[model samples]
Target: MFGIRPSQKVLLLWSTPVDAEELQAMVGELKSVVGAEGKVAVENVEMLADSSHAGSHFDLILAGVLPPFQFENSLNVLGEALRILKPGGSLIVRTTDSATTQSTLKLTGFTSVSQPEDASLTDEQKRDIISPVSEITCLKPNFEVGSSMKLSFAKAPAKPSANTWNINLTDDDVDLEDPDDLLTEEDLIRPDPTTLKVCGTTGKRKACKNCSCGLKEELDAEDEKRVEENKKNFKSSCGNCYLGDAFRCASCPYMGMPAFKPGEKVKLAESTLQDTS
Candidate 1:
């Protein structure tokens, strides 16, 4: 309000009903602060009706369309509102997702979202969500000191691999249409798929969190309930490597780190470097 130019009017479009008296007082306060006569208009809004009427060239459109618990257009709805805003103007939408900003830009057809992600957020709701800006840039204990340090990750990182990297066309390497042997996770020490098993709800519960094993899934079958119940103690690995998190791909960074084994962390200091002479 203090910074309002003599020429411009502030338009308030909100989904909730505003207190007219308070709004009038706020406008009055703004006018008094600015020492200029200006206009302020307030409108109540529902998203699906008259979405286009909200703004034509709004310098700023602050939006807060609560997301549906079921999949809905909350992200894209806000983005559409953002599209009507003037360049260098803003369409601020408060949301809980870490990817909200990127989603906002992408949905509105922007190539990139700004860094220090929290800067784009509204100051009021900023406290509640993951401020990727601050959290991503916070001081690190092992960082180089007495100098500025920066990190930029490529959108695509190279797929890490095991065994030898060969450009050569050998029999071992694929020579397509010639003698060749395809290297598989089988060549690596892949755990046996047969050794791994999963239990459905009909199966004796192995605690929840098992993926649907399409092979043995027969929860709908009336005759198989007993069989499934008996199989609940089942164990399984991601069939070979291409399907699930498995031991073979434990070394593959794409597969990610293995689950921490019990007691391994407690004994870490003793397991590492020995007291050498």
Candidate 2:
């Protein structure tokens, strides 16, 4: 009843225990159909239900080989069968319960699940095998499990044309006013230096002791200029200013001043002016 060809691998699966002679006979028949080049494996349905076989191994799977073959765990058996069978492989199930078997086969992911009208068994063979045998055939899908392919009919979205954009603007929509016109009189006026704090410190113009804002340098320059102006106008009454401190009068204005050449200009060190006493 199996349309097994030569050189095609086949599996004969039986759930119920059968006579050793009958089992051998079934194996012999399957072997003849497959021939020497082909392979035929006989296994109990429980073995496949509990565990799994190598996927896509068998070309055809003949389930429920004996008559009155009813699977208690139909889903597991058929699912395992589908897993083991190669893509586009055929499965023939000889079942007494056609409705349940068909439903289980479809649920197990087998495609084209249907019952054959003619089982092609002779009257004598039917009598011997017991009557009312229904054969259900199904095929594993052509594509393997988890396999994918893009559809040829599916079209990609068309790209939008550059002409579709509305970039042309009317004169009324455009603003021709100069950017400078946006500023007010106050914005154009310069900010006061006193109001602007140096280095963003708490008080205005209050620079850090070790100043980095150039404010310290500017003040130092002004002090140096004042000192230079004072020195230019000074006329030493004692006339001992060019000599060292020891030669000058104790009340001398240049008392702490260092000795220098007669014509050389002397710049006093800042520490000399401090009133330590």
lDDT of 2 by residue, 36-90 (tens): 9999988888787565568999999887756545444378677788888999999
- Specify the highest-lDDT model's number: 2
Give stretches of model 2 more than 4 Å off: 116-118, 121-131, 161-165, 168-277
Lowest lDDT block of 10, candidate 2: 116-125
User: Model 1, 158-237: lDDT tens per residue?
Assistant: 67687758565767766356323556566767776544444556454243455456433443353366544433422334
Give residue 6's lDDT in candidate 2 (0 to 100). Answer: 96
Provide the clashing-pair count of each candidate structure: 6, 0
TM-scores vs. true structure, each candidate: 0.29, 0.55
Off by over 4 Å in 1: 1-6, 16-39, 45-55, 64-76, 110-112, 115-277
**Strongest candidate by TM-score:** 2
Error of 2 at 151 (Å): 3.3
Clashing pairs in 1: 196-235, 196-236, 197-235, 197-236, 203-228, 204-229
